[model samples]
Every structure is written in structure tokens, then in C-alpha cells.
Target chain A: MASTDTFTDIRGCPSGARPLHRPRRRVPREPPASSFPTRSGDFGTGARTRTGTGARLRNPAERARRQWAVSGWAGLSVVCRPGVGGMAQSRGMTSIKATSGGESAVRVRGLVKHYGSTKALDGVDLDVRQGTVLGVLGPNGAGKTTLVRVLSTLVQPDAGTAMVAGYDVLTQPRQLRRVIGLTGQYASVDEKLSGRENLYMIGRLLDLSRKDARRRAEEMLERFSLTEAAKRPAAQYSGGMRRRLDLAASMVGHPAVLYLDEPTTGLDPRTRNEVWREVRRMVGDGSTVLLTTQYMEEAEQLADELTVVDRGRVIAEGRVDELKARIGGRTLRIRPTDGHRPAEMAEALAASPVTGVGGATADVEDGTVTVPIVDDDQLTAVVRLLAERGFGIAEIGTSLPSLDEVFLAVTGQKASVPQDPRPAADNSDDLEGAAV
Target chain B: MSTATITPPAAVRGARSEGRIGLRANLRHISALVRRNALQIKQDPESMFDALLMPIIFTLLFVYVFGGAISGKGHQAAYVNYVVPGLMAMMGMNIAQAVGTGINDDFKKGVMDRFRTMPIARSSVLIAKIVVEIGRMLVATAILLGMGFALGMTVHTDVLHLLAAVVLSLVFGASLMWIFILLGLTMKTAQSVQGVAMLVLMPLQFGSSIFAPTTTMPGWLQSFTDVNPLSNLADASRALVNGGAVAHSVWMTLAWAIGITAVTAPLAVMRFRKKA
Candidate 1:
């Protein structure tokens, strides 16, 4: 049965085929006063299964375990729920209370930021709960990093209200700083200091007693697997090690809210997984993480609820799976036997309930015909229909929607590796010792 | 979990004392920074060698080589006496670059950013750097005086003149430091700070009377050198060391220090805030 609850673009744009690709360029109206808060809230509002690469539907048992994990933590309140289904027309602030009664980790109302004449955040209102990870997924120039910087108190917004851990960003920034940690795209660790000393220095600044600071430093050193090299200066460490140390340093304060801006922009797959594990560990310990990344796989694997921002405005947001489901549940694929047989394969596949007739002969050169299947059962019916029509089918496959597809569909843009050029080192030593 | 929830008088006192924690925290940070840099220097004494050795070498070179040529006919004026004071002032100015380089190194290493994100006193980082520089300038001064005495550069004045000359030179050194500190903060690249400092210091020193009397220069150059801060500092220092009249140059030296401080301090603070 087709659910009429399916959201269609009000302007009659086709769903699941053509994505709402036009860039949102206008400034949004002001959010309502009720939505403003002095700071952000806690995390862990909800959870579900962690999908593995194996071709299996979500198991009932896994869902129950996830539900348990989400609820067992002490409850923290969510300030606002993301507007569902349709595009947000008004800039009105929406007050949302989390499942837990605790204060929100972040509260923002009509937070608009601009760079010169170009607007980076066109009046965005976001309420991230405490102890949970909120993954910010966006195409290039989506203002994800800008929003993170503003909330982290590194950059000031041109207009609107924001609070982190209950401290006003503008008025009570110093107090707010005590309760948060920020990691930038590049590692912000001091390469000259030993890994242990870096953590200890941060701990000392956070008002930890000497004994407590040393203890915390030791704990972090072991946690990030740097204990063996903790005494060695960070300059000798590898790129991944430095990145890990940067994240570990931010955790020295045990900040209530952590802002990670593209934490893994340049890392090998193995290192990326290690970082993902570390993030999970942090969330499990009840720390709220707000991370921005260009890697869709990272977002799909880690985000509890993802927000897709484009050109400074939120275009879509939902649980990762739900978002994928909205943009066509599955894709059916097939291959033809010969390089020139695309027309023959398209004819046979089109007869078997496929929606579109599109492909080059080279796509079918491997003897394949691909189709988008709504249900797995359709695969069996398609194969039988192909056989009945005396069409030779060499290969067929079905796959779920990917983050890249969702990104392309929603923003009408393909995902590319993010460009973040590190500045070149210059020679000269007069005051050279002054720069770090 | 609470039994009658009563507040203690001691708790109130503790809360009151907490207000001063910010100051204490900053002091702690300053001490930590100084200790860290000092330890680095202790482990590698070669870094401090330049400060101690460079002044002595330059003083000798100036007194013997250029001193006689500028003193001219040498009938009355002692060239060694004339060169000592100017060399002492020049030594202080040269050592001031050490302060800028120290701060610049910390900034380039991401140490300053780490400090910024911390809850430590905001101004303590720069203050610690200045403290380190003052200590370095003292060492340089000692080397310079030792070399000058060996070269027959005698001071005709008493202890007060020696003390005042050293103090004035240190003040002038600090004034130069303020200008460079501003440079270090404004120029993001360490190389840029080095380039700009060399560009300013070399010309200023060359144009001053550290190596020769400004009266010996050409018409336009003489007037420019006469008003130069370096010349004023050298002349005042020479008067103090030789027991000569403490003329208007003394006030001029003090005025230059005060003037530069007044203008550069605010600009430095602004740049520091912007970068932070």
C-alpha cells in the first residue's frame, strides 16, 4: 500500500527521481522568540540498529538492543525537534523538549551568519540534545563549519541568539567555553609538546587539581593508544596520531558539548574507523558531539539523526535510513550480454515493471539490465518475467539508497572530496620563533 | 540524598575567594610558560650563547675599527669612551628581537591557540614572554660591559650613572619589544615578522649615531639621524657613561620610549584580541 504521507515538493517536483536541486539563496525570516536558549542541551534522544554491510533487513533483536541503549542513559532534554516532511516556510522558532528532562546542550534561534555579502547561515535554528551525536551532512559551502564555529564560540554570528551548555554565546562566552570542546578541520595540537603534556596542559587550564590533571592525562594517553609514545613530542607522530591527539585533548575537559568540524578530512580508511569508534565511545560516555564531515559513509555509519544543509539552509533532516527511504527505497540493476544490446535489454527490463528506460550499451556490455525495486520480492518476479520473455539476463543486483545518492537527489550535486589546503611553510628566522 | 540542606558559613567564604581565581590562574600560567622555555634553554645552552656572545663581539669590532675613524684626529676625545655607551644601547635593541621571536615561535607551534582555548589568564602568555626577554637583555648587557672594560672603556661616572644607564637601556629595549610584539601578532607568518623587523631595525641602526657622530653625516642625513631614537638613546647613554652633561637627549630618549609605548601598546592589544 502506498502511504499518502509521502512528502512531495509543493511545487510539483517529482520525488525519488529528480531531487530538489536548486540552491536555496534567500535569507530566511526571523525565528520566534520562544525558541531562543542560553545554551545547548544533552544527547541520546533515540536509537536504532547499526546496519552492517551484509544484505539483511534490520533484525528485530538489534532494534530492541538499540532502544535499550538510548533509554538507559540519564535523560537529557532536547530543545527542538527538526521540522518534519515539508520545507520550512517561516523562520519561526520551534520549542521542542527532549525525552529526558535535562537542559538542552545547545539552543539556537534565528542564528544567521554571513561572510561579506554572501550568507553562510541564513537564519538557522538548531537544538542539539546532550550526550548524543548529531552529524551535520552537507555539500560544499553548506555553512556546516560556520555553524559549528559560531556554536563553539570561535566565530560570532551577525544576528540571532545561541547558547551552549546554557551559556549565552555572546554575553557569557567564557563560562560557556568551560563546558565545551572544539576540534577544527586541521589538528589543533601543539606539535612541540609531548602527547601527555598537551593533555595535562589542557587539564590544568580547565582547573583540574595537579593530581587529577596527571591522572586524566594518563587516562587519555592510554585511551588514544599514545601511552607508548606519550613522552615523545607530537612532531614525530603520524598524521592520524596527531588527529587522535587533537580529539583526545578536547576530551580532557570532559566538556558537556563537543564541536568537531570535519574531524577526519584526510585519513586512511583504517584511521577513519578508529575515529568512528572513538566517537562512539565518547557518546556512550554521555558526551554530546556535533561533527561536520564531507564523507557520506562516515555520516551514514555514525549519525543517529542527520541534517542535510545546503547553501546555509537546512534542506532535509531525519534518521539516516528514513532519509534514504524517502529518496527511493532500493535500486535494481541488470547487465546485457553484448555491447550493442542496450535497447534489447531496456525493452525487456521496461516490460518487467521498471520506471525508466536509460542506459548506454557499455553499461549492458557485461550482459546486465538494472531496475529500481520497491521490494526484494520483486527480484524473483523480474527474473521470471525476463525468462518468460526469452531475454538473456547475465547479471542482476539490488541495493539500498546511499548517502551520496541522497545528497545528489536533494542538492542536485555529487559528493566530491572536500578541499582543505594547509598553508605552506615559509623560511626566515628573525621573528620566526614567534609563530607556531 | 540531602539532610536538611543547610548552607555553611565557610562555603560562603570559599565562594567569595573564588572571584580571585582568575588572577591566580593567570599567574600560574605565566610561571608555567617561563619554566617551560627556561627548561628548553637549560637542556640546550647553545640557544642562550648568541645573546651572551654577540654583544661582546660587536662591541670590540665597533670600538677598534670604526671608533677611531669617527673620533677624527683623536686629540681630545677618547674613542673607546665614546664607543662604549653607543655599543651598550645597540646591544639592548638587538636583544629585544629575542622576545619577538620567542612569542612568534609559540604562536607558530599552535601553543598560543591552545592557550587561548584554555581558561588561563589571557594576558599572561605575552607577559611571560616579556619577562623572559628582560632576563635575556640583562645577560647581553653583562657581556657588553665585560668586553668594554677589557678594551679600556672606563666609566668616569659613579655607580648611579652605571645603574641609570643600564635601566634606561633596558627601558629602551622594552620599548623596541612592544613594537616587535605587535608585529608578531599582526603578521600571521613567522617569516613575515622576521622580514619586517629586519627591514626596520637595520635601517634605523644604520641611520643612528651608534657607529659615528650624526654631525659627520650629510645635510639631510644629519638632521634625520639627529632626531632618530637610536641616536638619542646613544647620546644619553654616552653622557651617563662619560660623566658629561645630561642634556636634552636624555629627555628625548625617554620621550621616544614613552611615545612608542603609548602608540604601540593599544595597537598590539587590539591585534592580540583580533587574532585570539
Candidate 2:
């Protein structure tokens, strides 16, 4: 369970300060960020500060300092003094430092975003420790994209606050922008520009010198294995190549925090694995990544933490194994060849808690009986009972709890794509007429 | 790894020099947009052919067909002098749809969304679109002006006057970009921009004194035409080409141009930010 203190802190109303004589003050706790149940291995290691309101009122710089101190992961010291003259130099950025020293790369408190009347993000709070991958798993329209947008500075939040890379998102957006890279779901490259030109354009946008932009563009083309096709216009590029180029273009400035919003939505397994390898490479180089995915196996494979969001709120969060363990029971499958009786097969599977009793002769194409046992120990009993019934078994296996089942269990909706308001034609004639 | 411990002086200096490079990046983005527009022109020359060809065709057809009735000049005579300036002003106004339609297409195609995530300057995308508009305007000007010259339209003004006229036309052309940018943000469809912008611009061209002198129009229409920026622009262009006195209308035309740009630029930018 999430801490009561974290929830109260997010409310900004001190729990103990409520007046007994006054009317009831209704304060809604901010929704926790989409993430899995975090292990308590390091929670109390950090301090949460409360700066004085007077200090916040004096100077904007002091206010940023207060927010930073209040919000930043505890062990690191971040000082903000007035005067633009020495501010950049005083940050001590002589050499690039890894963000892994007991500091959260991202922190949000009571962040809320509303699109008209629809609350896209219903007050999201998050803490991402440095250099780890936090995968946001949610069905479509679960506010994953909205959360990423706010943290990335693409969208403004209605309420609450967030800090990225020790910079307050609202107060220090320009600085925050420099330290983060965002790759949205759609390809953003200019179709008229060549792949090389597209990367070069982004490099230029990130403030690289002309020579450096060219150099970076060349490097990215090679890194994404797009060097051969670099001179061709992006309009002619394949879907997978375009996605690779899009990801490559986002890396022009070597941002510290990378946000990949449903990065592999339209990719094939091989191409998806290629993107996964690049993400792994980035994380290996000490870049903190926030990825939103609908793929369960993807979260299990790459994420250090998983957060499941449903209907704009986080329903469950934790490491993948912890989520799997919480599913409580595993289903065991039994395949018996030429079963003596269907009753014997049903009885074997019904020995444990008996949550369900199901078997089908057609479950095995070759005239055999199959049953599902929902307990680990029940599997042995099934084997013994089958032998006692003088029935030979063909094969048996256990199916572990899957993320699909978890999603259905939590959201009460089968994981499927929501119907978009706009419908595009099939374009069968165009597809057939296009050059391969 | 090779055991070379030496660091080049360039490398050492480069590491220490922390100069601001955002301006250069923005300049590069603008140049890239120009190149991209050039490539688009290359791929679909027919699409841009209309911007250049339409103005010339309109000059030829309108001058030959309507110049005799409107200005009492025969088609074979000096009708080119009467219609060329109008054609030039109309060319700028005609290409306003290209900016709005192109921007609307880009918005619909998710191009703007893509640009938002890019490390480039946020203003550069719109700036690039405006730069492309300037090119289209110049192309249209060249085509119409060349057609007029080919048809024995003599310039009584000196080279300086001609240059000033061209510069004024281009300034007016650039100012026209803000309205299109704002329209592009307001309208969801590229085709709707064509339908709506034409409805607004066609009257501004025909209802004004572009085709004929304001003296030829009715009294109520003449007053409206006098205040029309298009009329002032056409009058200014005519005075420059005819080597007449630098008219008071040039100042009014410039004022309108500056005023529209001032009001619309901020609104366009704000709308763009909201859309993104």
C-alpha cells in the first residue's frame, strides 16, 4: 500500500492541523502515478522537506530552491541563489555527472491535468529514482500519454507540481527541456527532408553547431542502421525505419531523461526487439527512461518497476514478479490420453479450493481429456489420480499469471484498443497500386 | 585501446568554450525549412505552378477581356500598364491560401505534433512556413512582372523606384502571412481554408480598386475602397512604377501592414501553442 504520509503530503493539508470545531474540509488525495508496488528497500533513506511560505514569497529563485529541496530525492544538495551571472557556473556543471547518486530523476506531487471536462490525469504523483526504467502499463485512454506529456513539458498541468532533473517543470521548463528527450507515438520527422536532414534539423534545434549537427546526424544514422538510406527523403522510408529515425532524432542532445510514449505500438516483433535493444543500451549508459506500454511482456522484460493505470487512476503498481505473486494462484493444465471417465478428470482438478471445474474431451484434438487445476500441489494429486484410474497422460503444464489477466481483473475490461472517433477508409485500391 | 594520452588543443578549447548556440540552431532550422520547401517544390512543381502561372494568366485574361471596359484601353494597346500592378498585389493575396492550407495539412498530418517534441526552437516551425510563403510570393511577382514587361509595359520609374515597389509588395506579402497562420490554426481542414479564405480575399481583390481606379466606382464603394489596404498597396505600386510623387497612401498601406502583423502575429503564436 502507498504511504499515508505521501498521500497527506500530496494533499498539502497537514493531517494534524484540521480544526475540530470547523465544518468538514474535504481534501482529495492526489492519485498515485501508474507504477507497481515499490519494494520498501530505500523509502526512508530520503528526506521530504517543507519550506517556509515566507521564504517562498521573497524571490523566485528562493522559491525554486524551496521546491527543489522539498521535492528532490534526499541525499543530494541543490542550491539556487539569485543573479543570472553566476547561476549557471555555480551549478558546478564542469563535467557530466551521473544522476544515480540517491536522487530521483523525476518527482511529481498532486499533478492534475484536465482536457475540457475530462480529467485526463486525476492528480498524479510519482517518484522515479535515477537511472532505472519505469514502465507505465495501462489500457488506451488511461492517462499514460497525458502523464508523459506533462512531465515532458509538452502539456501544462492544471494543478499540482512536478520536478525533473532538479528543475521545477513550471518555473524552470527551459532547463528541464534540455535534459529530457521525448519520442511521441507518431513519426514527427519532416517527410520532405531526407533522413539525414531530419536528424540534422533536430540537432540544430537542440542548439548544436552546424558542424556538430552534421556529425551527430551521421552518428545517429549509423546507430539506427539507417546510413544507407540516409540520403533518401523520409517520405520513402519504411514504417520500422521511420520509427528508428524518429527515436534517433530525439537523441540529438543526449538528454538525461528519455520519455518513450507507446514506442513500439505499430512495430513487428523483430523491429520491436531492435527498439528494445536500443532502450536497453540507453539505460546501460545511465539514462533514466519512462516508457508507456500496453505489452505485458515488454514491462516484464525491461522495466524495473511497473505501474498499471485504469480510467485515469493507478489501480496497481510494483515490480513484475511482485505483481505476478499477487495473482495468488497458478493454473495447471492436464492432458490425459484415452481417459477412463470424464468424472475422474474433473475430480482431480476439483481437489483444491475448487474455484472452477472444467474439462473438455475436445481440448485435446486426439480423443483425450483435459482439465485445469488451480493449485500447485493439486498437480501431483492429478497425476496420482489419473494413474489410479488407469488412464495414460499425454502432457501436462502450468500457466503462470499473465498481465492480460491482471488487466482484466483490475480494469474489468478486456485489454483492447478503444474505438477512435475518426475512421479512415481501408484504401484497398491505394494499397494495391502502391510500389513495394 | 591505444595508449595515446595527448589531448588536442582544439579538443581542450572546445570543451571549455560554453557559448550559447540556440540562435545558430534556429537559423539552421529556418534554412532546413527552406530546403524542405525547395524539395517539395521539386517533387510537385505542378502544385506551385498555379501560384506563379495563375497571376500571369489572370493578368493576360483580365487585361485583354476587361481592361477596355474598365480603363477604356484596347487589349493590343497599353493595357499591360493598367493590369500588371494589380496582378502583383493580387499575387500576394492569392498565395495566402497556400500558407493556411499547407499549415492545415501539416496539422492534420501530425507534423506539428512531431515538431513539438523536436529539440528545435518552437517558433522556427511557423517561421519556416512564413519563409516558404515569401518564396511563393516572389515567384508569383517575377512571373507576372515578366509577363507585363514582355507585353511592352514600359517602366517610367528608375531602377530605385522599381526596387522600392518590389520591396513594398514583398513587405505586404510577408504581412499577409500572419492572417493565414491564424486562419490555419482556427480551421481544422485544409480544404476549408481554401473555401473560407477565398470568400474573404476575392472580395478584397475585386471590390477594392485593384482592377480599376477608385474614381470609377460608386461613392459608397469608393470610400470603402480608399480605406482598403489592397487599394493603398495597388496605388503605391502604380505611383512607384509610373515615377509619380511618392503618395501619402504608401504610409497608410504600410501602417495597415504593420498593424495587421502586430495584432495577428501574437494571436497566431498563441493559437499555435494551444494547438500543440
Candidate 3:
């Protein structure tokens, strides 16, 4: 499960330090008063302090204090600083380390591929360090699969260049293929062949001797938990079983780099977790992975870094935590007790110096007041203010923005729902891109 | 799933630094794919329906229904000898079309992507399919000849000549496969491949001397049959099995086989390379 808490101190803070405020009496619901905008304004400025450079200059110590608050968080230390150029420079430095290190497993530059008039990959660039998963996060028709295909040498790029495991995708495709394994979105296995046969055949094609191929097939079956169904035709296997078999087939060569293009796109949660575990095991065994997925949770769970692509371009690239922080820090949610109007709580918090300046706003539908908190002190301030005002608090928790929220904030459009019925068009675009 | 501790296999460890697959490895890969195709056929017997049933139905229908009219009313037995060898050519044409549909289906299944990504000869994938289809053609030929022998169709020539005719049909069948394989590599779907194959097969089957002598046809039709590779194969097999002039048709069949293969094999390979 993805951890909702982004702030380590807040999650581990003692509850006794911030007493819970229980409602003594019910308050009538009233139409929000005209004072709501003024309250929202006070909190909005406090929220803007982290993003506004003028506010940072007003208090030189404020930057150092906020840095201490976020420094403990992985991948968020440098990014949390409040300058566009500084953040951009830090991101560049990280990628430079990723690309320049001798451990870079796959490097791509200006990989442009056009299918008819549609540019499937328009000047795409990427760098994945060795033994780490670089999750290519994208929605459908975003050219994530095209990038995988080009890097795997299954499709030739019209222009640009890519090197996987030190071999050029175009000039050294044959040698590149010897070191990379690709598992396509669809389970590309021989449906009529038994699971064992599929793995054995791949093994033999990889230049293994007959005896070694058999041994490798058996070993893979056991490792992937497909030993029980080794003799059954893959066509008879369930969806998850076939996916496991397909994954096992790719692993037969023990490739140095594995490209999994949406490996768990439609799998149930249990099977998805199983796939995640298998990926972790592979990475543990020193195989670098380039995983493409639309599920933000999958990326957050497995990727060391993520490259968010939209319409054949990289919109954002960073570690998962860094991407979340790029949008904003943690949000505090305060739910009022039953019949206690949330608007009143928002009004009260808006007048206070601490909670009032942090952009607290009431959502009537959820009956909660949300505040964007820059530090743990704001949360404690809100709790103390609510208790002093005798307002009943039903629930209180601070959570980092979900990746879904980050995706929306960065792309300016909602990520397509996983179960959206528009897959037909998306799939045709994918097939066209692949077929070319 | 339990974390089953697994050490990487020796083959995988040793293969990490391996270069492009050599000729020996290519042959091995082709043979493995051939075994895979054979296994798939065994598992799904329906895939062999055309090969197994087409020969039987065509042999019986052509020998009994058209035998009387084509060989003269009272000498149907002569038609059996004439039609049975010609059916070999028909079987070859029909089964070769199946190669196209089979390859098209493989492409749709996305397994071709898996093969393309592997460190193996690209031609091995197509060669294995052709090898299996040729095996299927041979099976259909045996069934056709078995039905012919049961119907009082005699090989008037020696057994060596009969063997030579069977070998000739296999060669012609194998060569014809490249054309269909090219179709498979280029067509958008299996149904389109089948539809276009039927259009090609119809003219080559009916316009040739398979069911009736080309000498009695119209002038224009005779010219087509004379140049038709299927016609050459039928005429050569007929001469070898029933004892007739063999040189012209046999040499023509070999030349057509060589020409079709020479023209189509490279095209098919090039198409396969570019398809993805």
C-alpha cells in the first residue's frame, strides 16, 4: 500500500501533545457567510509563502527552517527549496548523475518516431541508472509503449538514438537484443504451447543448449510459481497465470535490462502485488527495469524515479516524492463532529495567525476543512485553535497529495480512468504506433 | 507467492556477453520454433482441419463426381489416375495458403514481437512456419494418394517415379509457401490474407489442367495454364505417375519453383524486417 503520510514527524508525533477536541453540542448548518473569502485569503498568503520568492526574502531564516522540516524526506530536500532555477538545476544534476555514472543501463536521446502523421515519440529523451526501476508514467496514447518498443529493438525508430545495456538500439540491435528482455502489454506467449514449452523455446532461441534450456525452464517455472501449471497450455491459463508465464519467459535469458510495458495494467490487486514482488526480486538480482504504467500507485510503489509523459513529451521527471512535492506539500483535513458546520470551523481557523494564513477552506460536501500546511507547527496550531473554540473534531489527518492529484496539477487534465471505455481508440493508436 | 530462492541459470549467465547468433544457433532456433509449431498443432488439432480434411473431401469429390464426364462415361478408373496426381497440386496450393493465414494469426497474437526481440535469426521464425506447413502438405498428399490407391488409381510407372512425383510436389509446395508467407508478412489481417489467397488460388486451380486437360480449353485460357506454376506441377506429377512425356512439364515446374522462390523469399524477408 502507498503510504499517505509524506511528513515523517507529523505521522510519528505524540497524540497527547495535540489533544483531541470532542464536540459538546450540535451546531445548526448555516449558509456560508460572506466572511469566507477573507478567511480563504489569509490562509492563501501563508500557502504562497513557500512558492513566492518575495515572501522568502522577507524572512531569511524562514528558508532555513522550512528546509529542516523537509530535509528528512527522501528526494524532497533540494526540490522543496523555493526557487524555479534552483529546483531545475537540482533536477538536472540528478539526471546528470543518472546518465553520466558508469552504471547507466539505458540512455535515449531525441528518439523521434512518426507513424504516418502522428509523432509517437517526438524528441523523447531518457536515462535509467543500473539496477533501478525507471517508471515511464503516462496515460494511453502517450507513447510510453512506443519508447519501450524502440528501446527493445522490436520497432525501429525513424530518427534519434537509444542505447540499452551499452549497445545502440539501431546500430547494435542484434547485440542489444542479447542483453535486454521485453514483456509487452499483451502477454505475448504461444497460447497453444504449455507454460514450460514457452519458456524452453525462448531459452533455446537465446542460444541455450537443449539440456540447459530445459533446466532453465524448470527453474523459471518454480521461481514464478508456475510449476503446477507447467504442462498446461497457456491458452487454458487464467489472465494472471498467463501474465506470469509471459513474465517468466522474458526472464529466461536473465537479461541485464527488462522492459515491462504495463505489466499489471488489468490485473487484480493480489496479482498486481505478486507482480510487484517479482519485479523487486528481479531488481534484487541486479537487473535494471524500465516499467511503464498508468497507475500512479504502481509507480510510487516500485519506481526509483518517474518520467511522466503526455502527448509524446516528458512533462515532469523526478523521484515520486519530488514530483508530489513539486505540486505542494501535505494537506491537513479536519472533519467536524456530526451537525457541527465545517464553515464555522474554517471561519475560526481563518482568523487565527497560524491556521488562518495556511489557505484553510471548507468543503461542504465532505464536511471538512482542508488546510495546506508547510510545517508540523501549522497542524498543531489548528488543533489548539479548534480545542480553544470548543469545536468538535470528528477526524484529523495530514496527507501528502496523492499522485493522482500531482498528475492533474502537472498535466492540467485528469488522467484517464483505468477502466475507461475509450480503450478501443487508444489501443488502435498503440497498434498503429507498434505496427509501423 | 513465496520467495523461491533461485540462482540464475548457467546458460543465462553465460549468454550475457554473447554476440549475434551464429549459423549453428540460427539452425537451432529454427528447429526449436519448428517444434513449437508442431506442439501447437498437436495441442490444437483444429488447426490441422484444412490439411487433414481438405485432401480427403477433394479427392473423393473430384474422383467420383467429375471422373465419369472428364475421363469418358465408361472409363472412370482412368480419371482416378489422372485426377489424383493433379489433386496433389491442388493440395499444395490450398495448404500453402494456410501458411499465410497461420503467419498472419501469429502476427496478431503479438508473439512475433517476442521473436523479434530475441537474439535469433529473424528468418528462423518464417522458415519454421514454412517447414511445418510443408509437413502438413506432405500429410495431405499421403491422404490424397491413399484415397487414390483405394479407388483403383494405379501408378503406371515404377515406384521410383511415383516417389519422384511426390518429392516434386513437396518442392513445389514448399516454394509456393514463400509467396503466401510474403502475403502473411504484408497483409493487415488473417481474413484479408485468406480472402486474397482464395482469389489467387481459384484461377490457379480451375484454369490449370488439374481437373480437365488444358488442350480442350479456349486459346487464352490455355496460355494461362501453360504458364501457371500449379499447372506445371500437375502436368509433371501426372507424367511421372501415369507414364507420359515428362521433360517439358518437369523442367518447367522446377524453373517456376526456382523463379517464385527467388523473387519472393527476399521480399518476404525484407517485409518481415520492416513489418514492426
Q: Rate the local accuracy (lDDT) of all candidates.
A: 0.63, 0.64, 0.74
The residue pairs found clashing in candidate 2 are A35-A307, A35-A317, A36-A306, A36-A317, A36-A318, A37-A317, A37-A318, A205-B120
RMSD, one per candidate, in order: 13.3, 16.4, 11.3
Q: Give the proportion of true interface contacts each model preserves, from 0 to 1.
A: 0.18, 0.34, 0.68
Q: Tell me the deviation in Å of residue A386 in model 1.
A: 16
Give each model's clash number: 44, 8, 2
Q: Where does candidate 3 stray beyond 4 Å?
A: A2-89, A92-102, A333-350, A355-357, A361-369, A375-398, A414-436, B1-18
Point to the candidate with the largest lDDT: 3
**Model 1 CA lDDT for position A333:** 53
In model 3, pairs of residues that clash are A43-A357, A43-A359
For the candidates in turn, chain A alone yields TM-scores of 0.64, 0.60, 0.69
Worst 10 residues of 1 chain A by lDDT: A1-10
Task: Give the candidate number with the greatest DockQ.
Answer: 3
> B106-217, model 1: which lDDT tens digit per residue?
7767566556655455566677777777788888888888877787777898878987888888888888888888888877677878888889888788899887777768
Q: For model 3, how does the per-residue alpha-carbon lDDT over A100-139 read when each residue is reduced to its tens digit?
A: 3235689888889889988889878788866567889988
